[model samples]
Target: MECDASTIVSGFVEKVVSRYAESIDRDNVAPPEFFRDAAGHGVFGLPIPREYGGWGLPFSDFMDALRLIARESPSIAHIIFVHSMSAYFVEKFGSEEAREEILPGAARGERILALAFTEPGAGSDLASIETRAEKRGDTYVLEGEKLFTTNALYADTFIVLARTGPLEARHKALTLFALDKAEGVEVGEPLDLMGFRGTGLARVLLKGVEVPSSRVLGRENEGFKPAVVGLGVGRLPFASIALGIAEGALEEAVRWALERKSFGRPIFENQAVSFPLAEVAAEVEAVKALIRRTAELHDKGENILLHASIAKFLAARLAVKATRIAVQVMGGRGLLTASKVSRLYRDAKAAEIAEGTNEVQLMIIARDLAKRVR
Candidate 1:
């Protein structure tokens, strides 16, 4: 079946894909003009309600759009994903005031939102976070540090998770706030990373930052549920991004293979290079199927946590392998800085680390299996 938003997304890809890559690798930033074009094209609001200036498309369409963007620049796609995902959470769980304050700006792409869940001490163990949000009469005084927050420096808003009660409460005491980086919030310098260099990942410090009570998202002490649900929704898009990266790598490898000659014949004629390319193609297709199936489960309102984890884990592993093999197929040309395959190889590593690490996804799946057994 034809997808609803694919045609619009194709236009976006055609216009902005090459620009995204140039800005990401050379400028180390997403160009403002590129974001302006995306906003004008109704991309930022794909999942939000039409009343809120969004397209009101389903998650599947959203996933497709993200994949298309990711094919050109994963970092730009990462920025878009975080903002759209934050909008989704606010629409579902935020109070009326919170929604009204954030959704419109998000829809307009005027507000960029980032998630602040990871801490220096709590990498994947979210319950161990020490960021505290002490309640005052009509506000919360937040004091803590968040690490590895994507778009932190550039974001206008943050969905910050902070400890609200006793240590034993852990997950139960966790609360989420829709915080603006106005007064007490401080963002550190951006991280110079191995890949996804364009994403403004930074350390955020909230020093007695006062957030209005209305900024609380969802019910007090009930943040974990929406957080986990948001992750389930996010995984499919991340998998799609991985698929795009692999496809890009494969395309580059094929082009190089056809042009590069060895033994008086094109490299494509060699069994060794051709075999790996074929295998990579098959792996990408298989992962695409897995992503589609998981997306279907989500659309059907079925429990998708297990399937989401499976898709994420499989896609991440395959992306790394496929990109590596593509690089190998292109030989020395692939290792050159100017080669697109070289960029894909780096982007693939970032894909494995983002959303959730491959190791983390596997553990989540294993835990679900254990619960089923019990």
Candidate 2:
């Protein structure tokens, strides 16, 4: 049975995430208690199936929940999104034994997960990853450094991508593994980020970490497929986060416009203020429609590469635009670092960069259009 989205969203998310968003940003760390509390509320298991100890909600339901959480705290929303995405990968492609072993704990938030796909040299290009996994009898020895690993400090399990073949093989040489933190796995201190803070983002060093053959995710040397599939499916939720940012920014702007008076009248009475807010209000609905439709396609087991890209692309850009307008409406007050509008403004840029950049999304769209016309 599906968990009640309203209950979870209203009761826990608003009370906790909204209350702590500023402190989370100011301290640049989401306390462990935050995650534990979320676990107690089933926030981590919104999309996983009931048999796996999750709520078994649909993708759209999860997105609705994500949007609300992001509106309160984008950092928390992003953290949950990455964690849930890893759980999705495991349940979708992992072996039955692996699922039985990992999913229940992950669903319960007992085992936090991270994606270790990016390297210092391999950012957008997954084929050039320099990490190596050498086979030795029944175990594989992994040695590589993963960069920009979200949840690096807190993740009990990592979904890692390494090269099992020569670099000349390109994407074919890559492999995926589900690795638990061990003696050789070292996590660096969290990096100071401009936005999406408090996520425990850090670099992970794997110095000859060993894993059993059973830990391999999907097939060896064919990991690129599952990686691509997981990333593609992840874009829609990413879009939902951006939608939340836009919604939050707009809300702040509307409040400021209504309250801040200029020359004895509320600033909202001015056409300059009202028109932009009105336009963004309409745009927000458009983005919600797009995300809802894309999420519906995903629930039907349809390919969402192009549609997800569109949703992410538009939503991220709209977030930046909406935040900018909010800040402008607040005038100098919005510039204060402590202001919610300012924080939202800073956080909005990360949406465009993560889940693939706006340029990458455009390229994907262009490539799809090119193929369709031929």
Tell me the tens digit of each residue's lDDT in model 1 across 171-248.
Answer: 898888889987468999888877776777899999899999898988778887788778767888888888888888
Which segments of candidate 1 are over 4 A away from where they belong? 1-4
**Global lDDT scores for all candidate models:** 0.82, 0.90
Assess candidate 1 and give its lDDT: 0.82
Worst 10 residues of 1 by lDDT: 1-10
Best by TM-score: 2
**How far is 102's C-alpha from truth in model 1 (Å)?**
0.9
TM-score of each: 0.95, 0.98
lDDT of 2 by residue, 56-156 (tens): 88999888988998887889998899999998888988888888888898889888989999999998787899999999999999999999888888899
Best by lDDT: 2
The 10-residue segment with the lowest total lDDT in model 2: 1-10
CA RMSD of each candidate after superposition: 2.1, 1.0
Collision count for each candidate, in order: 0, 0
Write out the backbone clash pairs for model 1.
none
